[model samples]
Target: MKPRIIMNFALIITLYSALTFYIGWNGWIWLHTAFGLQDKWIFGVILELISFSYIIGHFLKGIPFFKVIGAYWFGLLQYAILFLPLANLIALVLIYLNLPTTTIVKWVGAFVLAAFIVLFLYGSFNAYSPVVRKYSLAIPKNAGKLTKLRIAMASDMHFGRLSGISHARRLVREVNALKPDLILMPGDIIDDDPEPFIQKNFGDVMKDLSAPLGVFGVLGNHEYYGGGIPRYLTEMNRIGITILLDQVTNIADSFYLVGRKDKTDRDRMPIEDLLMNTEINLPIIMMDHQPAELKQAEKNHVDLLLSGHTHRGQMAPNHLITKRMFEVDWGYLKKNQLHTIVSSGFGFWGPPLRIGSRSEIIQIDVTFV
Candidate 1:
């Protein structure tokens, strides 16, 4: 592992461990005082077990049954991590006012547990079910002979324990239901673990996706993090999904579609280089993963840019991070002739949950003026 990766993992593990410990301590106190539960140590052990399972799950992707169990546990851990803080804060407020903490603790504990249960349950279903987010863009009058084009696009379908063949089938079904002339995937198709995809035979279902103009995709950060670019490329190719790494193609005799590799590539080609040989007069629709470098795309006279990676914060308060990080984190942004659409993503990366953002597929109705 790279030093940076090792350091990041160490930092995450340390922080997660601290949070787990805090929640367990507070929870035990609540159980002991409010409900007279004598098994505080047992509860602590259970929390430890859950944490361990999550930590090891990252390494157990190749394992069969353990991976599934670990994944579910990891999902639970994600919810707990978020809920515990709020629960603890509530207890703190009661104590701060010098009120009766024991009674309040019970109410807080019960409320936290119930709320998390509902949140995770809803999030699971939500993550599995993606809604179509449609947009309409007009091609400049100077470009293209094609009058109208229907493009169905999605991104961040992190296929693994949380999202596998079943989720893949649903997305493919929805995309096909749209009867689009073209299909585009911005990136993060595979999660960090590619083993689960192999175990689930996800490609078999994905192969059924129908787009007459063909399905094309760019590389996402996860594609490199997942550690199997060639394997993913081969699998996508087997399913007839074209993986375009900083390449441009003209389709439908009307527009140019350009796909760029994720910024993870240290030597990634620039937009200028990718479009250098292409006909600039045609309407160019670019699919780049992170949504950075808009000026470059605009400079190259890119008519439309489709991207996904942010997941629009995926959870509350996190959206604040993405909003500040990217120039166009979510939704549509147009500057003169250059247009951009960034999807919150069709699937999730972790927790199998979305607290603030909705998973979405972009149904773009492009009219060549």
Candidate 2:
């Protein structure tokens, strides 16, 4: 790695370690005073293990228990980082007011616990409950004899250990119910590892997803991280779903469905180059996993662009960052003649919790003139 890359990585590690230490220290103080616990070594060890469990589980794929613990810890860690300092500040104020130590601890602890519980409950509901977000738009170009097309799209399914068989079944049931003429998945179809998806037989559940115009998908960054593109493609094809990697297909001579390699792929073709051979006269619908290149799609005359991968930050306040990161982070955006629709995603990444965003599927009704 380059010197700058190494430096940045080191900085991230240092920051994570410092934050984890802060959280652990506060937690230890709470336990010691509130519950009369004095075993500092045990607390420190456990905290460290939990803090790094996600990394451990990621590399050692055999140990799923660590991943589960780590996933929940991550959700807690985010809120803890946000609220813990405030709790500490409040405690300091209480001390200045000459409040009893026990009373101060009790009040702060109770408030923090209640806040965390409410966030977890609400966030869990938002993560698990998938909603259909509908969009109706018109294209000036004609698509053969077809005047309208109903496209059902779900991106960032991230099906793995966290989002298992139940989520897969729910997705299949939901999309099939929509009875869309076409189904498009803009990616992150599986979590980092494809083993869990295959081992748990999620393919069987997903194979039930039905659409007459067929189901198509492109890879997200996560797919590249997993490095199981060939296997993922094979499994998806087996289930009648096509994983299109920088490829285009004409759909019944009506419209073109273009799927691009993720932005993460260094060799990913440019929009103009990818469409060079294609007949642009037809209504062209394209899927690029991340909504980072809307201008390129619009400039290339892509009629409709589908994407996800934002998750709209997945948690609150985080959406603010994503909003600035991507032009259209969560919903629809009209850039000139191009119609871009980006879903918040049907699944999540780290924690199966969503604060500001809900798991969603996009149902787009396209009318071609």
lDDT: which candidate is best?
A: 2
Q: lDDT (CA) for every model shown? A: 0.84, 0.93
My TM-score estimates for the predictions, one after another, are 0.89, 0.98
The TM-score between candidate 2 and the true structure equals 0.98
The clash numbers for all candidates, in the given order, read 0, 0
Residue clash pairs of candidate 1: none
Best by TM-score: 2
Question: What value of lDDT does candidate 1 attain over all alpha carbons?
Answer: 0.84
Error of 1 at 186 (Å): 0.8
lDDT per residue for candidate 2 within 1-369, as digits (tens), equals 899999999999999999999998888887887888989999999999999999999888898999999999989999999999899999999999998978898779878889999999999999999999999999999798899999999999999988878999999999999999999999899997788999999999988888889989999999999989889888988899998889999999999999999999999999999999988799899999999999999999999999999999999889999999999998999988999999999999889999989999889999999
- Flag regions of model 1 displaced more than 4 Å: 1-14, 34-36, 64-102, 141-145
Candidate 1, after superposition: displacement of residue 152 in Å?
A: 0.1
